[model samples]
Target chain A: MSTEISIQRSVKPLGKDELAALVARDIAPGSFVNLGIGQPTLVSNYLTEEQNITLHTENGMLGMGPEAVGEQIDGDLINAGKIPVTELPGASYFHHADSFAIMRGGHLDICVLGAFQVSATGDLANWHTGAPDAIPAVGGAMDLATGAKDVFVMMTLLTRDGTSKLVEACTYPLTGVGCVTRVYTDKAVFLIGPDGVTVRETFGITLEELQQLVPVPLKATSAVGV
Target chain B: MLQFIDTVGEAVAGIRDGSTVMIGGFGNAGQPFELIDALLDSGATDLTVVNNNAGQGDQGLALLIKEGRVRKMICSFPRQSDSWHFDEKYRAGKIELELVPQGNLAERIRAAGAGIGGFFTPTGYGTMLAEGKETRFLDGKWQVFETPIHADVALIKALTADRKGNLVYRKTARNFGPIMAAAAKHTIVQVSEIVPTGALDPENIVTPGIYVNSIVRVAGTPAERAA
Candidate 1:
């Protein structure tokens, strides 16, 4: 007896900012979120206050706001990166221990982190390159990855060399396994599925063309023209 | 009854060379200096040290690195301070370093204490960190594989402790102490004071005695270790 196989078509990609907005829409009101350092940190500026989201920093502040103007900056009140920041009303200070408890105890609803490579299986590898000269720091990315209820990866879709950051499997040392739930990229957003990476939507490109852009083999199916 | 040793040198007597040790504190805020000094005097080499930060400029764990005792270090940021030893040795390829993101380091230790083998994360995707590891997709995004971390001994500090070994830390000193206590096979705590067992309230205890194997009370402040 012969067995039949089926393939699915790919989806389009979204711009970096557009993907950020998409992630913002997914966050529920009153949710506790951790915006990781670098690009993921930019998501804080776009979160609508109506959502009532409470931002947390590993450095011991909660109910954090985006970076403030020079005059408004408080030298003592800063985030984990030591960047000057503003605190929203109802904010309180706690021991750094409590701040980490909120993270390690899995109390956070969402954690958005920048990425180096996202695999088809949703593996993360953002810290330590094994480079002899590199400083070798993992920061707080590891905790946020494993502790958050949901994780969203924010990064460019491809490297400068045109290589896709999303792959069939990660080749670098892992930070967490199967912790990511969604991916938002400059070109497109892909959902890592048991069947493989399934494209949810795209920004300016088409499905057929996206297949050519991605390094991993696309599961071909019907046309998903957008 | 809990016996308080006269000096830190007598407290760390059983620790041998090539032992895996977890040190407490974030940056240099709450390190166990007395215990570190004793470990140094013991001349234990080939040590695998785990901590949040390596301590500023050869003052804390840097002393170990300088003595050529440390074979490897697993931490979040090793050079967050002005430590010449880390830069000089790391540059010379003398020390093996595994850098864990701060949060992940905490979780990995906690996971080991909680009896979990491995957990998932999405922190390192698309960077050099994703070069060689297993990955999986959950919900819709990418997450990487991060294994648990554990140690053979934990050298920790506490603001206060009762004779029963219930610990309390002041401010940032509590950084990795509680979790380190849980992750290590044997935890030796150095504290400023050791009060009666019932003196510490259950609510205020940071690390329960169940996780601590021994307690040593320092006579002087962490700064007086040299004297």
Candidate 2:
């Protein structure tokens, strides 16, 4: 397991399916959740029907399944990301206001989102990068991060250029402040709290190795290989 | 009272220049394409358009902007892979954009229909979006005040509507239609089917006739309507 996790800088990153499976392993049963647009959308595919966890898309569909296959794609069955997906049993359609009301009203138990960077203090910066040409893509992220009972981010620990996403402060325009609760990265899982970001689990590396690799110094805890 | 209008041109004729209009859709799913075409032909200019996206293709609201009809846009998802029109015009500073958090955008529009002045939301509390807006920590959370977005006119699409203007939306494509209908002064709905009064099941009606102003019939079967 340790050798398998030794990622070369030039090697391809872990596919979203493996990351989704990792995120899905910890979700409690009977929780209503919303998966964010990108990598977070894959989390729904890993959940079992037995979990009884309901999925909501902000564009007005609840009880969605994985993305629809080739012929199964329906133009009208798009999720919030505008990607086609299948619906589970007892699926329902709603108006935009009511759907967002469910989001902002804090009915979701958890929201899995993809982030550009997360601060040590749980602030999130996903809407815009620190670039002039970057369009502000503040879709439903602000609402999801702040409104959900818990916010879990799924992303790589490092950017493609090897910059650590776990930082002292995020430079990108914030989607919300102190809203993130947990982070599921390709390398490890972090719990963001008032004290700061802490490692809950790592893929196969020790806390010392991860600390050396990242930009920020780690408050090394009993990092388990979960 | 029957509110089904004669044609798309007739329904869009009341739209004046500089009117703030809410067009319903998440992308093109529930877009009122025909009404937009008519609005384009009518030469209405300086229009403030509000919706979820900044339009996708060369036609529709994007076309309205390409023709320089739109002065401003209030939307949540302002960029898409194919949203070149918005990207170009916005970069050129020719068109203005007010990016809203999607939930806040929906709630503001909902607030208008519900007759609420404004509300506080935890979203955008400490972000750049909260700058200049009144904010406070309430119940152990930071919140920002969002005002209602009341549009002068609303152009929406529905799956089926009765002559009395009661609307029933399709599966997931029903994004902003009902709420936009409620938040605007005049709501013109384009539905694939127009049934007689009391024909649609009352239990299934999403937007009651009281909120809707008029309905336009689009040529498509009920099955195709949901497609």
Candidate 3:
């Protein structure tokens, strides 16, 4: 709850591309991954060709290529975001049912999503803010949260008001119950599981500083590094 | 037998008010805009429409909602930056909404087409959406029961079709088209080109003629097609 707590040491939080590249490096090669529409989409830009990662868009395609430009912009060819996109070589298209089946059936290995809040026990709340006036539009957030083998979240550690998004329990309406496996944030990367929140790596803050920022109890992994 | 209709008006003719219609598309891709416009012209009202989003801008489904033709919208993501039509109608209590999860929506439609009664899935379990649904612990996870979504008519766009009504879609525009064609009682399609029967390769055919009711050839709309 304290916004004024500052570490004596200088620490700059990871840049947007830096955070995205960090996530890209962690994905296993040849894995099937679905990146949620917003911030998670940045991870795709950091992916290396050798990773051989196949992108899955909930709308209905596998082997999705990058955003389509100029002559390549086909209305029919698009990502889940509905922005025009291209198809990679060896790409295959299916109907909506089969596309979701790829996720719900556990064929997808990893999915990265942006979150409004993530509970210590891995509960995810990203779809709706539970506001009365806001129109509720939950696309594939629930499906991806509960369906993927591992649900990785990409979000800022704190809101602009300096409140921690990683909470003991989600204040927003949950997208999935205890479904998150890892969270990649601007401040630190956390691995959530039965034991508790583990600080895998920190960007600009120390484990001790992050512990003070987040409400949940945090433990550092033996592998923690800058 | 599939009939090649000459006009969008004739293609969408005979749709009664209060009918459940499935309009295939993910956003604007694969949406049968001409057919939707024709349906609008037919003066059908109080219809329950199903699609991914409620509507994007003041066109296609958006225009229909703007005209107050749709009574209810069954979709996953109805809120977008450009979804002002649905947002206004929803806020003003002029429209009804059934916000199903994307996966469940797709599966429910598929179940209807496949003639399945109902099935259980973990997509919405333990969430607000699963509140009243039956739940069972299956395959090491809690799953919620969901039923099929059948429709009186379906409007879909595709790239190419043969005289037999075999379909081949262009890229991601294929979303919801195949399942919707099967889930509806009558499936009306608009294609860029329609070839003679047996012109389509059987193996490459996405939706077979059996599921399709009628077809219309729409010369590529200048704005919609790739430049």
Best candidate according to lDDT: 3
TM-score of each: 0.64, 0.93, 0.96
Candidates, ranked, TM-score = 3, 2, 1
Q: Quick one: ranking by DockQ, best first?
A: 2, 3, 1
Residue B94 error, candidate 2, Å:
1.0
Top candidate when judged by DockQ against the true structure: 2
Instruction: Name the fnat for model 1.
Output: 0.31
Candidate 2 local Cα displacement, residue B15, angstroms: 0.8
Fnat of the models, one by one?
Answer: 0.31, 0.83, 0.81
Model 1: per-residue Cα lDDT over A152-192, one tens digit each? 99988888898888877877667777777778886666776
lDDT string for model 3 (B1-227, tens) is 67899999999888999999999988888888888999999999999999999988878899999999999999999999999999999999999999999999999999999999999999878788999899999999889999999999999998888988889987778889999999999999999888888888898999988999999988875237432
Calculate DockQ per candidate and list them: 0.16, 0.63, 0.61
Candidate 3 on A140-218: residue-level lDDT in tens? 9999999999999999999999999999899898899989999998888899989999998787787878888999999
C-alpha lDDT of residue B48 in model 2 = 98
Model 2: per-residue Cα lDDT at residue B20: 99
Q: Cα RMSD to native, each candidate?
A: 9.4, 3.5, 4.2
Could you list the chain B TM-scores for each candidate? 0.92, 0.96, 0.97
Model 2 residue A72 lDDT? 85
